[model samples]
Target: MSGCYIHIPFCAQKCSYCDFHFSTNHSYQNEMVEALCTELKIRSESWKDEEFQTIYFGGGTPSVLTSGQLQKLIGQVKSGYRVSNQVEITLECNPDDCSTENLTTWKKLGVNRLSIGIQSFNDEQLKWMNRSHSAADGLNAVRNAKQTGFDELSLDLMYGLPNMTAEEWKSQLLQVIALNPEHISAYCLTVEQRTALSKWVKEGKLTVSSNEQQSEQFELLVSTLKEAGYEQYEISNFARNEHYSKHNTAYWQGVKYLGIGPSAHGYNGKERYWNQANNKAYMTALKQGNLPETIEILSSFDRFNETLMIGLRTKWGVSKLQLFEDISPDKEWFKIVKDYEDQQLLIETPESIVLTEAGRLLADGIAAELFIIN
Candidate 1:
């Protein structure tokens, strides 16, 4: 089944660590909405008639949109695409943007899933992160969503802060467990270039977490969540039973999807395309009847490398035998896999090469080590 992702490039305010395409200017709200709808129409006509199983609204903050604006966008999607009756419609929201009224309206507009960005329950952490919501706002938002009958709730949390203690991390996890969300996406705070967080670190205004601290927090997360009966479906995601995010899992499995809006990426079985990240440029090009995107045709090696990278991040490991089936297995790939296996970092079954729990802690490094150099 195909999936669709729509990026809403507006936020209440820019987060310190966020590098996503977004503006805090409210003046462009109406124009942005119009451009998004136009993009949907433009992309939909070119798309083959595939029934969509998932429709995800992600962004700088999708919750910034009003209920009326949301209804209009969903209506456009319904008119343009063949969405299945069982579509998993998700809306990414921030606590400050959610209220009882808005939650009811969101539910009415076919939003079956709510992904709330509740990074931390601690007010200090929230302030440090420059989030648009308070700790109380976050707690209220979850209750409002549940009251509105959204059982498919996923909360985003972050660990590995510069001054956070292990006790604080454990406390946050316990609090989340108390809320009883269906899924939890816990991420380590990474300082990307050009973000405020990086600048603060450089200027000595803020301290970044050391590798050891990050590793410790990750271990705490896995052990704590597992004890609470959550499965580590992905390296960074935990879910209860069959409630894993179908939309995200489809992407990890290399399924075809259409992405609309500025700074969005789409992948078919063969090629990948990314829309222009600049909102003004995207709207201007689309208004001039252009798609405003760049495409890359994947080679055999490229596809193989991608499959290897994505497969390792997932619980469903990649088959070593299947690697040779897709491309000529070279000594370089074999050496990397064998090195990891010998270290007990990877468990090599006859059919699959799976990451051990320790290996998952260093997944990016392991995946990078296996990249097919051109």
Candidate 2:
């Protein structure tokens, strides 16, 4: 099934480690809403026959938008595209934005899922990350979401902070478990270039976590979540009762999705396109009835490599027969797979080949090694 992603590129404050396309300007909210709805209308013509199974509002902060703004955008999608009755609508919210009133409003608007960005419940860490929410606010948000009756709830956590000890990481995980969220996404803290965190590291103002520490924390995360009856469906995501992020899962499985708004990416199986990152340019183009984007037609090699990279990261590995058919007659590739299997890094079943627990640590490396360089 296909999905639709709406990018909200406005945030109250930029996170220290975030490098995603976002602006702290709230003045352009109304204009952005108009442009987004217009873009959705323009793109919906191609998908008139298609029905979306999931609708995700991802962003700098989707919660930053008012209920009216959100409704207008959702209304556009309802009128312009065919959405399934069981569509999973998700909105990414920060803890501070999860007020009872806001939660009730979103629930009424049919937002079935809420992915709260509670990076850390520790006050110091929250401050370090430049998040607006306090530790109390994070806990209160979860309680409020649960009380508001969201169909599914997910919490985002980060580990491998330079100053976070093993015990502290454990505390964070336990706190999340206590909240009883349906899904949990734990990510390693990586300092991307051009981000405040990266600059701090380069200036010797902040220390970054070592690879060894990150690895240990990752192992801890998997074991702790597994013990809590959560399935590690993806490398960084854990879910209970099969309540996985259908939108993200579909993306990994090569399902086509329409991306709305600036800096958004869309894939249509054969070709991928991304909108211009600049908000002004995006709005101007939409006003002029043009799509401000670049498209790339995927070659066979590109498709194969992407399949391997994305497929191997999930609990569902690449289909053995399909992989063989796609990259058949390549003895070298077969040899590489054999070597990995022999090393116990990959487990081969009759239907598919999945990574072992140890292999997961080197997932990126393994995918890279198996890439079909053209």
lDDT tens string, model 2, 1-374?
A: 69999999999998999999999998989999999999998898888878999999999899999999999999999889999999999999999999999999999998999999999989999998999999999999999998998859999999999788888999999999999999999999999999999989999988988998899899999999999999998999999999999999998877889999999999987899999999999999999999988999998788888888888999998776655655653788778888999999998788887998888999999999988877
Top candidate by lDDT: 2
Each model's lDDT: 0.89, 0.92
Candidate 1: stretches off by over 4 Å: 319-325
RMSD per prediction, one decimal?
1.6, 1.1
TM-score of each: 0.96, 0.98
> What TM-score quantifies how close candidate 1 is to the native fold?
0.96
Across residues 33-150, which tens digit of lDDT does each residue of candidate 1 receive?
8888998888887675777899999998999898888898899888998999999999999998888888888998999999999999999889978998999999999998888899
Off by over 4 Å in 2: 321-326
Worst 10 residues of 1 by lDDT: 319-328
